[model samples]
Target: MTAPPPEQRPDRPRRCFVIGPIGNSYAAHGSPERAAYEHHLEVFEEVISPACEKFGITALRADGIASPGDINEQICRHVIESDLVVADLSGGNPNVMYELGLRHLWGLPVIHIGEDGQLPFDIASVRTIKYQRTRTSLAGTRRRIESALAAGIQDGFELLTPARVLRAIQPGAGPAPERPPARPPGREGGGDLPGLLDDCASVEDGLDGVTGQLAAISGAIETVGTLAERSGAEALDLLQAGAPAIARLAAVSRLADALRAPAGELHALTRDFSARTAALDSGMRTALGLVEAAGPEERDEGNADFLDQLVSLDEEVRAALSRLAALSASAGRMHLLSRHLREPVRDLSGALRQLRSAVTCMGGWAAAARGLLPAAAG
Candidate 1:
């Protein structure tokens, strides 16, 4: 359970809004810049959407949303309000740059994405997920983004979280943008991330319960898989021994019922536990962040103990999340295996039906033969 990066992750609104060039007002219609703009759209639809869906995040585009009021107001709201914002830096679209700057001023994390060799020099130092339009490149990028989203990794921050922006909107503005509100005394910081950390810490006491339930689900899934495999094998043996159709069907029926019980229970349990784990990560990611520590003289023994508690709690939360993810994966595999196990049972049932029909036909033939023989003797 290594400590997560020292950064507070805000409670994501569970939505990601795209900020990029969707227009060619500056570039010619058939020019390379226009082509690049179209390519970005493709990347969003093909690559980003899948990854977002996998982690339960909704992806929205600037133009896709509608509002009765000003469109700029809507865009600004999403820029400030969305849990996550992905900015496309290709061609250095002024609108994108402006919006990206605004998000940074608010000190929220924004994922920068662009084409290789196309970012402006100023932002070149910033970490950007560059990609080509090729199928392979897009596919790999999707995987990378999904992994980052799951782990709460940011592409860039701080530099993006600029201290100020021009408030006057004029050349040589009177002064820089207003500073964000100061954090409260004795608190980690302000904004969504700090508050979210506090919210998550509140749930620390229930972590033990979550871990126990996850363990139970994992065990149940394993047990179900084993039972299904054994039952299927036994049914196969009966088939080879030429057992009565009724006996084979009855045996397989019992196995099918047994398999369903655990699979269903584990599936539901896994779903519920996964949600809790995600919530825990949401808070721990922020709480474990590297806020400014007070000087030695400012610190007391009580402060030291509190810090230790936070470190320990963070470690526990990370471990629990990792375990929960693995358990969920195991449960998924078990669900699939259970379904596979029932395939043979179904086949056996069909075979039994045919066998019963064959036996009935043979009895009818024998009865007719006996009647014909008596008639011939007469």
Candidate 2:
């Protein structure tokens, strides 16, 4: 008799929720603490919120809920309902930590994040992500959070760290074989699954590098906007100098106009990528679910129903892989476009440099002319 193919187990879908102190409660007791609370709100909205949206995870900010009685109870309800909880430990707020503890007790998957300086001693043993609280830090933090959330959703509570969780879900993972260990590029010892994990790690690293470049482009756009504003303010001064200097003034005007056009385009591209990246990250987490359910022992079953489900999941992974490839291609195009714009921007910068030198020379000549006039009058 032919041996039956192994029965595949069903993978469970993941649903995640975010929990933390909000409103006036996030800070310490006094007025001085109020500013800290505001800062937390800002980061939550600008950084964490976008990150959650990208990962297809529901983020519940406690501050938004109006019903007042027993806030902890409400937090507990959310945690119970969620497949995972991500807690922000910045400001060391007791309430958030307490909620986090409650989730931990339930043995649900939880990801902890804190500002670089605000990590609590109690969570020292637990894996936590450290993030900088500044606007400059938002994109990097968002990527890390997405990666962490993906890992957590895939592996459950026991696999808190990304590297550990990644190792577990990687195809062909098994206990290390006894041998004289050859060190692999991204693993402790040479192994097939570890090698695959290294490839995945490299992909994540490339994603991070792209994210950083996008952030730098965003920052540059902001800086250019500020420069354009300053140039506008200086326009009247330039006109007062002489009508003959109109060409230089016009050059500044054109540069500002040119900067605005490409900046807007780049901004749109970045926003689209941010949204797509979040979706891709979420989809990857869902794919990991299939791997989790396809445990070695489960494959012993030859049930047709389980095999059908496995086929469905395989199809889903194929779809996601295609989407990921498209996203990568779109990102590559955007990067190339950004690079293309840099040459024009450089030329504009040169024009501005020449204009500035002319303005300085005119100022020196004007001062000399005034000095000579005074001597002649005397």
Query: Which candidate leads in lDDT?
Result: 1
Off by over 4 Å in 1: 1-10, 24-34, 153-179, 182-378
TM-score for predicted model 2 compared with the true structure: 0.36
CA lDDT scores, all candidates in order: 0.55, 0.48
The stretch of ten residues in a row with the least summed lDDT in candidate 2 is 1-10
lDDT of model 1 at position 261: 61
How many clashing pairs in candidate 1? 3
Task: Report the lDDT tens digits of candidate 2 across residue range 1-378.
Answer: 011111321143244566654556555767656766776777677766676777665566766657888774565576645655678887656556556644543334677887888887757777777878576786688788878766644663353333244333342353212211112235533434343223235334534543454454445444555554565456556667654555554646564455655545544444444443443342222222222222332222222222333233334333433433343343334233334444435433433333233233323323323322323336
What is the TM-score of candidate 1? Answer: 0.39
